[model samples]
Target: MSDMYKAPQAELTNGEEHGDFGSVEKGIAGDYSFSISETVSEGWRLSKGKKRTVWLGILLYVIALIAITVVAGFITGVFTAEGDASFTQELIYNLITTIIGFPLAAGMTMIGIKIARGEDTSGTEVLAYFDKIVPLVIVNFLMAIFIFIGLLLLVLPGIYLMVAYLFAIPLVVDQNLGPWQALEASRKAVTKRWFSFLGFLILLLLIGLAGFLAVLIGMIWALPLLFIAIGVAYRKVFGSPHRA
Candidate 1:
C-alpha cells in the first residue's frame, strides 16, 4: 500500500473531518466530497506493474467474446444457409450475444477488484461469473434499457446515469449483489459526489485515448488502469463503514 492510497481524512466544506451540522444543503457535493486526483492516483498505484495479469485477463476476455460471436454467427449461418437471414433472426442473434457477453464483462470487473485488493488471481478468474450469470445478465440488460431511454430523452441524463451507475457491475461481482441491489447501491454511493466522479471518468477517457494514440498497443495498459481506477472508486464508496 502506497502512501497516496492511504485513506485520508474526509474533508468537508466547513473544514471539519466530522461535525454535527444541521440540514444545510451543500452546494455541489452532499455529505461526501470526491477528489479526482486522489482517485486517479490510487487507481494508478493499484494498476502499475500489474499489466501482465491484467493483460492476460483482457486477452482471455477478448478471446471469449470473439468465440461467442463466431459461434453465434456460425449457428445463424447454418440455420439460414438456404436463404438470407431474416431481420428478425439477426435481431435475436444479437440479443443472445448481448446476454452472454455481458456476464463476461462482470468477470473483468471481478479480476480488477481482486487485483485492487492485493489478491493473487489467475486470468481465468475472468470466468468467475459463470456460476452467478443470471443476476449479472439481468442487471446488464436493465441497465442497457435504462441508459438507452435516458440517452433518447436527454444526453446529459444518460451521461449522469452512466457515471452514477459505474460501480454497479463491480458491486455485483465483489459483493454478490442481485441486479437491483447492485444498481441501487451504486446510485446511492455516487449520487453524493456525482459531478466530481464524472470529472474523474472524463480524465480516465482521456488517459485511454492517449494510450490508443500510442500505436494502439498501449490500450493493454491504459484499459487496466481504467478498470483498476474503477475498483478504487468502488472501495472508497462501499469497502467499509469507515470509508463510507
Candidate 2:
C-alpha cells in the first residue's frame, strides 16, 4: 500500500511493508479515528455488537459530548450576555473558526499513535491528537470554509462533502497527507462503499430523530452502539477498510 494510505507506524518487516489494511469488517481503525460513524450507522448495514470496550467508550463519549455541547452553549450564552460585543458575538466568530482555532493536527496525530499502538481510544485521545499537531488545526479551519461554500450552494452537496471528508483527520494523522490529499483519501475510503455508506447515513438520521423524540438518552445510548455497528459493518460490506 502507498504510504499515503498507510499508517505512520508502518514498517518494512524484513523488506515487506504492510500497514494494517485489515479485513474491512474486522476494523482497520487501530491507528486512530474521529468519526461520525454513529451518525453514519443509522442507515448502513454495520452492526454495533455490545462489547466492554465499545460500551465503555460509548458511555464516556456520550457524557463528554453532552458536556461539551452544554458547555459550548454556555460559552455562547456568556458571549451573548454582554451586549453587542458579548461572548456570543465572539463565539459566533470562534465557532466559525473552530476548525482553525482548535487542535485539528493534535487530534489526528494522537489518534495515529493510538491506532498504531492498537490502544483503546476515547475523547481525550482526540484532544491529545490536537495537542500534538497544531498547524493542521488552521488548515481544518480553512477546509470548513470550503464546506460552508459547498453548503451555500445547497444542502445535499454539503452533506456529501461532510461525509466524504468525515474521516480526513484520521487519514491525515496516520498517513501524513496534506489537507486536500487527506480529504481526497478520506473521500475515496468512504465512497468505496457508497451504497452502504449512504444507506447508513440515512438510517442514522432516522435513528437520530427517534433519539430526539425519546429524549437525550436515546441519542446517548443509540449513538455509540449504532456507530460501533456501522464501523464493524463497513468492514463486512466493503471487505476493504480503505475502500469505504
Candidate 3:
C-alpha cells in the first residue's frame, strides 16, 4: 500500500534506487508486469487487517456525507419554499454542491493510500497527508474543475474526461507530484493499457453498483481491497516499494 517498498530500477547518484519494481505481472499492456489483486491484498495484510481503521474511515466518510446531504436538503427546501426557481439557480446550487466537500474527498484519497500501505493514519494523519499533498490536492481540484467545465459542454465528453483523469488521485498519493505532472503521467498510464483501460473502468463501475445495492456495507470490504490492488498496480507500473 505504501509506495515505500519498491525494488530499484536504477541506482541514484546518492545510491538510493529509483522507485520501480521491474517486470510486473498484471501490467495494463506490455508496459507493466504485475497483478492488481495481489498487491492490494499485500497492502491489507501489512495493515494488520484491523477493524479499527475501517471503522474510523467509514465514520469520517459518513459524517462528510451527512454534512453535504443536510446542506443540499436545506438548499432544496429553501428553493421549494420560495416556489419555482430558475435553471440558473439550480445550476448554481449544483456547483456549490460539488465544491462543498472537497476536504472530505481529499481525506478519502489519503485514507485509501494509507489503507493500501498498511499504515496507521489517524484522522490527524489524513490531514497530514493533505498538507504533504497540497500540490496533488490543488491539481486534483483544478482537474475536477476542468472536467466540470467539459461537462457543461457535452455530457459524454465530460465522462470521457473523468475517466482519463481517474488516476490523478492515486498518482499524486503514491508519487507526491504536482497536478500537471500527475495528469501527464496518468494520461500516459491510462493510454498504455489493456483495451484502452475501458475494461478497468467498467469493472469499477460494476463494483460501484454492487456496493450501492448492498447498502454500502460492501464498501467496507471492497474499498481496502481495491486500494490494495491499485497499490499493486502502482508497484507494477511505477516500480517496487509500490510493488507487492
Query: What TM-score fits each model?
Result: 0.80, 0.53, 0.59
Give the alpha-carbon lDDT of every model.
0.69, 0.47, 0.54
In angstroms, the error of model 3 at 19 is 8.6
lDDT of 3: 0.54
Give the true-structure RMSD of model 2.
9.7
Clashes (candidate 2): 25
Please provide, for model 1 over 1-244, each residue's C-alpha lDDT reduced to its tens digit, 9 standing for 90 to 100. 1223323232122112222121112211244445789767766876766666677778888999888887887776735555688887788778778878777888787666656555556577777777777887878877888888889886877887898788777667666678897887777668888888889889999999999999998897788898877755655555522222
**Which residues of candidate 1, in runs, are more than 4 Å off?**
1-33, 78-83, 240-244
| Regions of model 3 farther than 4 Å from truth | 1-32, 40-51, 68-92, 123-163, 172-176, 194-197, 207-217, 238-244
- Residue-level lDDT of model 3, residues 148-244, one tens digit each, is 9989987865766676676666566556566787676666665565344555556556665776689889766666555444544554464422444
Residue pairs that clash (backbone atoms under 3 angstroms), model 1 = none
As a whole number from 0 to 100, the lDDT of residue 154 in candidate 1 is 69
Candidate 2 local Cα displacement, residue 111, angstroms? 8.6
